[model samples]
Target: METSQITDLKRILANSLEGIEDPIERSRSDFCFYLENVVHDEGPHALTDYIQLADFHREIADTLMDDKTSFLLVEAFRGSGKSSLASVAWPAYLASLNPSLRFALISKTDDQAITQLTGIEAILRSAEHQRIFGDLVPHRQYYNFRAPWSEQEKVIVRPKFSRFPTFLAAGVESSLVVGKRFDCLVADDVIDLTSSFSPTTRNRIKHWFYQVLLPTRDQRWSKVVVIGTPWVADDLYDSIAKEMAGKSFFKHIRIPAIQTEQTDHGPIYKSAWPEVFPLTNLNRIKSEGHFAFQNQYMLERYDVTQSILKKEWLKLIQQDYIPKELTILQGIDPNAGRVTGKTGDMLALATVGIDADRQAYLLDLVYIKGDIQEQLLHITDHITRWNPKDIASEIEATQAHFKNYLEAKLKETLGLDITIRGITSKNVPKPIRLRAMFDAFIAGKVLVAAHVNWETGDLEPLPSLLPFVEEWISYSANAPHDDALDAVDIALSSVLEYGGRLAALTIPSEAIIIKDRENLEKEEEMSEEDLELADLLEKYEKNMTGTSVLANPSRFFQRRINFRGLNL
Candidate 1:
């Protein structure tokens, strides 16, 4: 643990036990005190030693204990003890405070719900609890008549109270809570991975929550707590957030595992619970997979199963297989402004090449994270290397100025005036354009260079391709960043517009054939301009006879039309 964390723990401990004399009262008042002095079966380590409590845990406990806040939603990271704190410990503490208040513990299934209720049962039946407060369970003589104890429900010894059990365990789809009412309701992990992916299951869970379980709450004085990790967008948690937008009684708290802050130099990342999950441990988890880490730990919800792009659609080939007469183009998707930190939008550039067969290849990709100068230099370097036939950039209100500046920079650096073509996506939706661009992948017309081992002939992905591939496989409509996809789409659209007929195989065979002249006497009476036009037309026909129009067809047409009024 860090020195600051130790200091914060000491201060928390002092405040928790400051003016409290009786142990029972201290445990009842402060939830942190209860976890430290009463609950002893947490794990192999003590609460104050190895598994030190974080401030967010205290915040959650305080919110649960608050009387004004009736509804609380906690979207915490996985493995952050949210279940133990909100569902088990908080309900037990409430029972200790007032033994007659009925509570409901809900999960995705009945078995999982009962498992969580068992934790509270074990705490109530512990000797420490009995020594501190009293016997919460009823005696053998009064078990059958007054209070009944079972796995599904546990009734404490509350004389002259309502017939509802002290704690009731039920699943989201269970009918045990049909007519039963409760003082407190805790929904834990009600939306699992399987339910999150299915719209039917998600709707069912939502219906049960809003229709059945919510009506069971005592309207006079009741509290509801929903605690779970976010699975995907528009799930139950998102529904709750939208429903309770500006309500003062509802409190929503989201705690990510890694917190980032931008400073003067760069970004700094720190763990939310450093004692439990340090920086080193968090980095190790991040290395496993970017999508998993973001979804589970960072609480960035993404449903890749619903994404349009798939991993198996990416085709890898050797670099030597590229045709010699390939035409390359560069695409740019610049950021709105200069990027200063990791959270800022990236400047994405993609170099795509096309062959006579209408196949596309991802030659190279560049991502810049600095200011405009750095981005300009990086783009200039790419232009120098690839010598692309055209450079296409997304030109919006924010990027129009940057485009002008980029053109000037190219003229100053390379001493060559190059005009950049602007591509606007305002009329078309992004997902539709992206689908059209990636359809080449589905058709087995897109290829990437594979990193090959010379001796063993083993093929792997090139280092420059990993980031793009990761984004490709995890592409969703609600993805955080789509700059790379936008860049590639721009480049692909330019290539298709120039040589789309060749790829679609829609050109007429008669367009490429040159018929013999009917009269040679009319050719002798032609002027010099007519003679030049005829010669040029014959040469163009010869070139188009057996070759594909994949080599800058737009430029070829412009040059031919500018020389004279020739239609071929």
Candidate 2:
């Protein structure tokens, strides 16, 4: 339909097709050869530098040239040459190689398929391509480019090769289930956060691939190549994991932003991929290696033995003595009132404190039941007894009645000012701070109190707590409700925001040391030293200094204390 297509046809009419029966076949084959060898040849780039991943393009060209392998599974980032090499140029060149190569270029949808074909079709129709390629192939259904390559000058250009090298954008489906037939099946950008997480949508894509795509691939050289940035584990990642189990027809190649190398120095040495990634100033691959390592380079699917959070890190935090000070922060599940009665999750109130050296000490937990008012009263009583500096409460979607009642009661009964800050979140639907906390835990940077129960005692509630955290770590951008894990959510959020300081229920007696045992025994005796210290405390409190600077000894001055004490 465009001028480029017309020019391509005219140029082919002028060029001489080296003896072939089908005009289409001769036309396609020559055009393919020209584009690969001359037009878009990525030559002279060093192989070691990832910049020359044009090797991947050349590899695809060779695979398309052969009749043996039809399926391909490619994993690369956005600029890793997926569209230019795989979708547009590759498929178009394949069709040009043999006009009769009845190939289907599929996409996430029909629209995407058409969209992919547009650029390639334009190139073919362009005057430069026509003059250089020497022939114009008719565009078929906005997908196929038909030409007569094997005949004389006057004959109608017809395809000589069989229908093949089809491009299909498949979601998540395995051929074992669906029965489709094709020479080649290429799936690009299959699953995203918006599509794969939905039960209905995911199932529908599964059916489409199994029932429609696989059954279509019934050829001697049948093959499937999947390519895309992995958004989650459910779609293609799950399939790849399953296929890895026994014998697999699929050959996998994972190319993260950073090329991997091994060295005795640090465990993972940097590889040569940086050469290619570094050339682009907008997003240097080397600079973003850490992000790529977490999001793409390492597969987070089945690395079970390496729990992100090491258990040993939690073991060092054992508090043998009664917590001298404690602060309880309660996170009520946003949906506490919408209970179905079958299974009701409660508001988890976990009390944490700072020891003499600013190390976080977990004291206890109160799992409460009942309506908002009842929970509010319990929280109030707990706070009064502890006299914490402040209760870090999550205000997002909290029950209005409970919040209002608590605030009013605090002002009226205790005359205490309660600060409740809502955790900010966007509509994009992902847990942010919770994931960061998990990362800290996994990296062995966080210490949990050793006194905390892990089995059935105080730690009993935590087994239930861990799965949700794991789910948060393993989740995609737009996931379902995390309302049930409100306690951990609030705690992690507050710690991240407020720099790990929590208000205690009572002035922790342990932080204050009496001058001596005799001073403790003396009744109503106010020494000058005590009065001076008391005056200093009054002045500090009046200045609104919320921090306990001298309150912490040892490693407290630093952002975090090295509580492990070199025991590791």
Candidate 3:
């Protein structure tokens, strides 16, 4: 942890010094150097801007310079300066250097594209900008400046001495320059909120993009660059990603707000800009607002309408306690794979215990994929280790093999006889079954036994248990992984008679503790003498060490008290 902190500090110091090192020369050469030193977009001596973003800007600059570049998709967070850096500084700098780089700036609406173009014009007019570009900078003599923001004022100053290309801004609905071809097409804010959420609007934007925008690309000069905050998982950006997956010219950079660090135990997500987005601040945002955090910062999307389980409904048991007098049950979802690989799904199994209050406390869960024999070996190991009182499995043709194999293995190797009851889990669809399980959670009938330590952002010492909560938080109808949810549903069956099977049967009398079911109600009605007698019995029980008690030496006094209670 100390090494990590020191490394972060060194990086910060290095970025702060980046501007000071040959500022004039580097500013002319590097995009990041120019932004930090000349324009001071982060304010005077901010010292600690997110320099992590600079590498991506450098990538864009390099790609623009390369001859073979075809497409670049950049998904960054809300305040990462995707527009200010790429849309403004990059184009102005490139135009100043060569002046022949024709560029078309675009957005979801005409007004937005104009806004980006205006930023470029404003930069071109800056004192430092004019000094650097000198005769090359755009001037009043080059093009007509118009009132407010419009298509007429959209193009940057035309090539003054050279027959090179210039910059133009247009909405997705607008046409590119009629007789002119754009060498580089840069798009920002391509999808608005309303259009992103509605299928009809997204489709409209898709149709408009192919019809109007694709034609603007000059296949010979530079690649198309689209930069924006991704609102939906399956938005237009996803379509491009799919089409470009196998192509050689396609490249994209997805910068998330929080970056995950892998630890020996598990992975922990820390803010990329901890100064601006500390974990405390992010935790509050995540706890109070789910969808916003996910869409804005995480660059992931979920249709909440299709969700059966709400993350906030999950309950965690405190005080590090599991109910002593409860029934233990197990549920299994076998993957029946030949190997542990990314190609196929895995096995999901869960153990649950039901208390007197009918609350189901999730005890343990296992999700893994491997060879069929290897998986059976894994399950056999779990059975020997857990020794759960009752086990449940869905009666599917695929699962029957797993069920028989598990039973057969346990008896053959471990010499333990276990029942594999046919648990019919497919009577309801997955969503419906998951919803049924979610109902139990929402009704406060389900609790997880996790240690109370949200400071480190998890229930430590219960490393195996933390993924259950994370799975709940990231669960969606179109989720890529369903092993966790399936396991949870199987565990929840311990509360219902799903498929003619009891959630859990009574524990045998020999295994039962606190056998008296009506003792609590009887306490209030019992007479003083009867209560005194019960008190003596409780004391005697407390004195026992194991099944035997060494004389308490104060037993004579206890015997006298017992005698007094008998006389009463």
Candidate 4:
């Protein structure tokens, strides 16, 4: 703070740069070095002492300095100091290299943008910075309006070759930089929680980003960097990720607070910043609320309230506890196209069994990425092992051929006649059907087999059901993929329907049942009135059979069906 101490600090910084040839150029080329030596707010201790530079920070620095990367999107967890590295230090280093460089810093609000601008101002005016970069802003004219040093904008003491200011800070809502172009643009935390949840706000921010902010790039040597924590799916960050995917000049980096690995014991959680946020500390944060922890720390994108299923609600029973007389049914959701890798779209098959009490147990789940033939082979293998009594499949109008092919394959391979019941999802939305199927789960009527270590009293998810469980817990109406959910929904819904118990719970308003063509031919000859009666009788027979239905005498009368002396 005093002049004498400032002189000593400058002298020490000068002595440190004495041996290096073109130390200023090194500061511009090596971002990490610049961040360490020239950009320090701590008094005596180095920046590393206050904030440890993790490997992801180094990667971010490399990305900022790389010439080939023109667009970089960083989604690091909270407290990662991404703003300091990308917004403050990187801009200061660039301005030190070229005094005429025009840089724009944007945030969610003007106050936040000004706060970040103050950091860059402090670093540029520091003793070490002036000693190396030679007085970027004249000390005497710092407050003078003609020199333009303020919270919103600052022009360095350089030749006025361009019309744009050397540094500008504004919010995403500001129109100050309508026609101005910049050498570097940084959009930081442009979408907060409020904006992330509102579609109109997210759309407005997205439009401003593409229509206004992005056009300010100089297009010759400009670099654009967007950095923030993920708030939700299809937020501005997700939109940017979708836009920049697979592009040569774009790079996206995501670093979560904890990394998980499955071991023989169980899952092990490793902290990304172990020195700062240890596993114990992260777990403590998780205890606060998993939804917040998942969004802010783990970088997952789903709201707990909006999620259709909860992991805690899924009952896990021991494998040997299953009833021997349970009727098993397999449901398959085949991928329309062939895929070879684990990351691609998958063919999902879920096997569910209904016990005498009409409780559904998720027996087995399989997700494979392959052609239809390969998918059929997996289905056959599961059926051979489980020996399910019935098989149901979701057959889109475009994929009707799969039903015939699968039936023929089953007859030929097993030497048995099995008709594949087709489920048509024509007018109904997937979320609606899934919600209807999970009604049983909410009522404590659905269960899953668990892998238990009885000696340790520890339990792990069944290996085959792990993927389905993950999808189930994270499922939202707008989830990108729902193959596993579809398979489970079809299987569970079919089991409930076959047991004549679907009407007891909330039935999917849309009729998803599709009979085979041969069964349809039998009803075509009936008269108009007879056909309506037959249809009702067929639905009643299919949806009403077990003692559970017989116990509910009022339910039969509620449907206005006359069953006076039919079977009772």
List, in order, the clash count of every candidate structure.
Answer: 0, 76, 1, 1
lDDT tens per residue, model 3, 489-510? 7666655642223222223211
lDDT-best of 1 and 3: 1
Pick by lDDT: which candidate is best? Answer: 1
Top candidate (TM-score): 1
lDDT by residue for model 2 (1-568), tens: 8999999987897575535456334445543444443344234652222213445555555554555444456666556666666666665555444433333455565456556566466555645456645464544543234332221111112444332222333223433223333555556666665565455676777667656766776555555666666644566546654555344454455555544556777556343245444435323332223223455543333222223333332313324333564433444333335233333345555455544433344444445556656666666676766655445444444344445556677888778777655444543233333544444333323334333331211222244344444444444444343443445555555453434532222222222222232344465765555445444544443464554424532112121122222221
Off by over 4 Å in 4: 1-28, 41-50, 141-146, 261-268, 303-568
RMSD of each: 23.0, 14.8, 18.8, 20.5
Query: All candidates' lDDT scores?
Result: 0.76, 0.46, 0.63, 0.74
Q: Model 1 segments beyond 4 Å from truth?
A: 1-20, 46-51, 303-568
Query: Which ten-residue region of model 4 has the weakest summed lDDT?
Result: 506-515
Candidate 3: lDDT over CA atoms? 0.63
Return whichever of 1 and 4 wins on TM-score: 1
Model 3, poorest ten-residue lDDT window?
Answer: 505-514
- lDDT (tens digit, per residue) of candidate 1 on 1-568: 9999999999999999888598776776777888767765367553433224689988998899889999999999988999988898778878877898999999988899999999898778877677766888887785776677889988987756577899999988789998998999999999876677667788998999999999999989999999999977779998998899799999999999998899999999989999789989887676434456677899987554467567766766545455678888889998757632334478889988888877677778887677877888889988998999888998876676677778888898889699989889765545545755665554445676565542322344567666678778778766777888888877886775565622532111112111112233346575677557556654664565643222434323223323366454
Of the two candidates 1 and 2, the one with more favorable TM-score, higher being better, is 1
Candidate 4 lDDT, 367-391, residue by residue in tens: 9887767887898899888888778
